[model samples]
Target: MNSAVIRLTKCSSTKCLAMFQLSYHSQPKVALDEGISSHRVQVGPHRLHYLRAGHGPHTLLLIPGVLGFGWSNFKHQLLGFDRDLFTTIAFDPPGNGYSRPPEKTFPPLEVEAETVAQFMEALGVESASVLGYSSGGRTAMVLAALHQRLVKKLVLASTHAFILPDEYKYSRSLDCIEETWNEKEKNILYGVYGKENLPKLWRQFNDFNERILKEQRGNICLHLLKDIKCPTQLICGQKDPLTKVENSWLLHALIENSRIHVYPEGKHSNQIKYAEDFNMRVQDFLMADEELSGTNIREEDIKLAKANSF
Candidate 1:
């Protein structure tokens, strides 16, 4: 028997677009009635593939990294949050996963923000708390700015607001004209989490970075982040090599009623790596804070949500 060694890299090309399946070994077996449901939405030239799960008060709208999608990367999020307490939703942005790719340049963050608004409206959800990771975080900021009423609160993980001279180089969009995805590209994919977890991390990084670089324009993220006004939470790994600390400072300063949290030994993927702590902090912030809070959630209820396996 041979064990597969998946390698991730910082490649920005089309050749690295390999179809890899994620084994469901990471999630716990505590049945929570969490499965994926999909929908097709038209946002300008792009048709987005969106996923939804669970049910409760205060819907959580999850936005994944540039090209990341589905529940695999967001397993911690889906599993950690009290599914019976809050309705959680995650989706594939344009040009990734089951979603349609862009026809022209990738839609701007503002445009994508509107698309999200449209999605909520179509589903009859008046408002939701926006949660974004990586470039998705930047997009959430944009959504809050454009649809302030619909966005009650915001959460950002491993995201940057504006370009820093030092940090811009790390983004695949800034480094290349058109990113190509291939099996062999030396990127932060493999070594993002030291050397031991390189194989797993590499696949995750390559799956996201490769497609995002080819389809997205980096400036959209920078411009839209400056306009946020909702209560926001920014979480980052202290050891994140790509997004520097200064960017979080700038985001916190620009966005009103925003807070920042840094995991001591965490990296860019801290939310996944430190799922227990990360989920606890998020639950605490959303429930305790007056501005961000609405419905009351019991801690005991969170611990005991069960799936109806009928």
Candidate 2:
């Protein structure tokens, strides 16, 4: 489907606003498989873009990190999951990726969560397992809290409930993305955001972090964390520079039915760096018959699993 165009009609709900049209361009090179299909739908005031894969009883909703879209951040899960048993849907939040025209202002996380809930409603997804990576986790926390019934299971990867002063400082230091990001990372971002907008967006995101630090005391979804009642899994990278491993522990402590898994040498983007292991682990957790135990898994267990694999 070259030059694939998705026509999104305005939602017919009472709360929905006026109708708007959107033209979506699906790149041929990035189209991974026939099972994955890209689409756009009008959700309230925003035209949301998303990718859907598989057709099964179970559903997985993937929320990407800051400046991330559905395909770029979640290609692995979209392709790796068993299509016969589980369906995966990944979306671009308002003002990001193909969902735009409103432009991202970095609204409060609760508002973002509402948008997500609305998006799911528009798509007819009643409930699903949710995986939110990095900043997306903030929105996911609020979603699980505000719309509890919409989330069956929750996964937070390299994310934190709130930002620390040091984190804000680190964010400020990354204002010049060209200097802070290595070539490979920069290339990936450039492919998603383009050369002209990538740097500006990064700077704007840094400014947003600063505003949250000052106005909201860096609390994105800390107040809502305890309200999330779903079986939660927190994936942390031990060597992560963005979100410290301690943040995962904090999240585990706050969410009663939560557990943590640490990747010894993994970094912030370990979901991509360790895609196979990460995918298998998430699949196991999401597919588990019963709720997994809480707190961190033992180091010896991790070693034992690795040894058994070998």
Candidate 3:
């Protein structure tokens, strides 16, 4: 498929204009349960679609990666977090999921971060504890660094501060969806972005990574890591091929008040594969009054976190 065809298939000018003009009245009501409700709001030029659950005092914002949407990436977190203690909001970034029309232009991470801040403001959220997965983590890092007061805490899962040479090569290899993704991965992506659009989106995402590598020297937010003052948690899978465990360790080293959790047998999609453990650890970190770092975490604390998860 040629670039022109892909661009047309993603979003036409007429459809894009209609989507933006009807933004206020086009929200469709979709509810998973009594607690989870789906909504859409206009954030500047983009219309953001999000899933909101719980009525707790604390707010948790979930940012998905690459071809990820709110429900596709954060099903476990949407259903598992204690409704009494936290209100979770998972959004589909512009051009992905239900938030479309503009298609993904792959702007700078700083621009994406600013859009996130605007999203929160549109939703009347003053501040939130943010959780970002994969590429979304890079955006989260930018958000925390540029808008420090808007983020209460931060979580980065299976992500990196900058793209490595190996990562760039791997991204290049993913141009062809059929050859790059496993059966399960294909099914998941197919469900979120239809079978026809999946390949195009994947290719576009790969191109975005390549641009970052060449133009920015793979730097997403490495220079801004030190500016992130919020208490942070870095979760990684030891066996992940994309963002390895070393990425998490490096993040922990750079972010002063940060801790690391490595899942032994987990892969790139560990958040979904190891949902129970991941949820517990994230909950524990967010709920803790004191900052949690590698130096302070203990065996009993782990047990306590597991106990309090439910």
lDDT of each: 0.60, 0.79, 0.78
Provide the TM-score for each candidate, comma-separated.
Answer: 0.66, 0.84, 0.83
Where model 3 places Cα greater than 4 Å from the true spot, the runs are 1-31, 293-310
Model 1 Cα lDDT, one tens digit per residue, 107-222: 55677778778878767889888888887887788888878899888888888754444544454333331243332222322212222343333344444444444445323354
Tell me the lDDT of candidate 1. Answer: 0.60
**Ten contiguous residues minimizing lDDT sum, candidate 1:** 301-310
Candidate 2 has a TM-score of 0.84
TM-score of 1: 0.66
Rank candidates, TM-score, best first: 2, 3, 1
Best by TM-score: 2
Per-residue accuracy of model 3 over 82-180 as CA lDDT, tens digit each? 899999999999977667666666788888999999999998899999999999999999999999999999999999986778877777787788877
Off by over 4 Å in 2: 1-29, 293-310
Residue 306 shift from truth in candidate 2, angstroms: 34
